[model samples]
Target: MYKIENLSFKYEKDKYALKDINMDFSKGDIIGVIGENGCGKSTLFMNMTGILKPNSGEIRYNDEKIKYGKKDLYNLRKKVGIVFQDPEKQIFYSKVYDDIAFTMRNIGMNEEDIKKRVEKALEAVNGSEFIDKPVQFLSYGQKKRVAIASVIAMQNETVLLDEPTSGLDPRSTDAVVDIIKNMKKNGTKVVISSHDMDLIYEICDYVYVMNKGEIIKAGNPDDVFMDEKMIKNAGLKTPWIIKIYNELKNNELKNGETKEETNLKTIKTKFAQYK
Candidate 1:
């Protein structure tokens, strides 16, 4: 639903934050952006959400070029919501409910609809039980949930999450992932950046590997991860699933079994049988 062409951005005169970035995001696709720190994942999201305008090139959503004009920018933001990497940076209200309701209120949504949406958004992030809790009292993971709730309450067609699973325990990471799945189920296209290789491999339909402000590789998870050199150069590791699959292939070959290429599902099933 969104297309970016030759996008370039420079924070300083001599340093470019993004360079000739091009991406086409379609409905129902969970796109993953993976790279080390300062690789411009957040910069790309900022430009996509109109928080930062590219110095050159264009972004088109549903065939219309995105402009910074008042109405156009407002409409673009309404369609695309971004959740920053740090929850503390985004959660301004003291209460969880109020923080989530902040956006709806600004848009002049009535109390009745706002209440329903607030509850629904919190529920989507599995934060309903702590709906009225003080933001300061919530855990870092809880604050992250609240941050996601704020975006969900906006009902944007696209959600951009920067390192959604960072700084959380396994349960919290799983919870954040569930939120991504729910967003996809609700037909909200999601573009997420994470250092978690396994999480990206598990949920993302397509992946973009970024290095030094440019995408080095972009493809389905298997194809992108297959390039070990590029993956390493981008400061990422191969997914555990791929590692195990390769091990299984080696074992089968050593045992004189037929060496067949296996997909994740087949490898999982075979591993279960082996166990």
Candidate 2:
């Protein structure tokens, strides 16, 4: 489990990036963190992964407190893998296979073991066919998959993804979403930071809505999306289905129906009834 208690950060002494943030994430949870730009969503992830230290707070993995020492930080980083928003920033080695094997090699894994693990990771992301291809030759989506493969090769217990679907076509978005679902099935704690409402509704089991460096609300997807005012206040819009449902509720435009009878399928059926 990952736990943050009273976490806070300030880029300058007078300006705060994150304020009194606290939350807990457990295995088998796909959490979506959303907010407007500069709400400190990325800052929070950076702190948890030890890329940035909090001005005052505690970040704990399991029950042990994390220390800032180089050795301890290295261990923590190995356990928590982060996929940046831009895939290009994470790719470095000449070939796809070498990039995926880079992290394992850095940690001093044996040659034979590294090869075996690299193959498995590639297979996980459906990239085994391109093992020898130069990363620069691969398309944007393929490079993203290779980036993910690199992290999976590390075998981390927790994965933090920053905008995994930022600049991809619909097909690539679906591919990345499939990988995230697979991670949850395997009991890895996956936390995603995204602005895509449809993606959140489709995959996230829980969500934390942030605004101005604070988490304003958190709950199941349906619960959080139902609050239109709270959602808009945080610089987000409700999903289309929820927005339609809300409008129907407010206008009393029921075809001999009540609010209690409305649900995802029911809403779809109602909208279809008009067509």
RMSD (CA, Å), each prediction: 2.0, 3.0
| Backbone clash tally (model 2) | 0
Q: Give me the overall lDDT of model 1.
A: 0.89
TM-score of 2: 0.92
Q: How close to the true structure is residue 24 of candidate 2, measured as C-alpha lDDT?
A: 76
Candidate 1 lDDT by residue in tens digits, 197-249:
99998899999889999988989998888788898899999998789877877
In candidate 1, which residue ranges exceed 4 Å CA deviation?
259-265, 270-275
Q: Model 2, residue 48: what's the lDDT?
A: 87
Give the TM-scores of the predictions, in the order they appear. 0.94, 0.92
Clashing pairs in 1: none
* Index of the highest-TM-score prediction: 1
Show pairs that collide, candidate 2: none
How much lDDT does candidate 2 score? 0.87
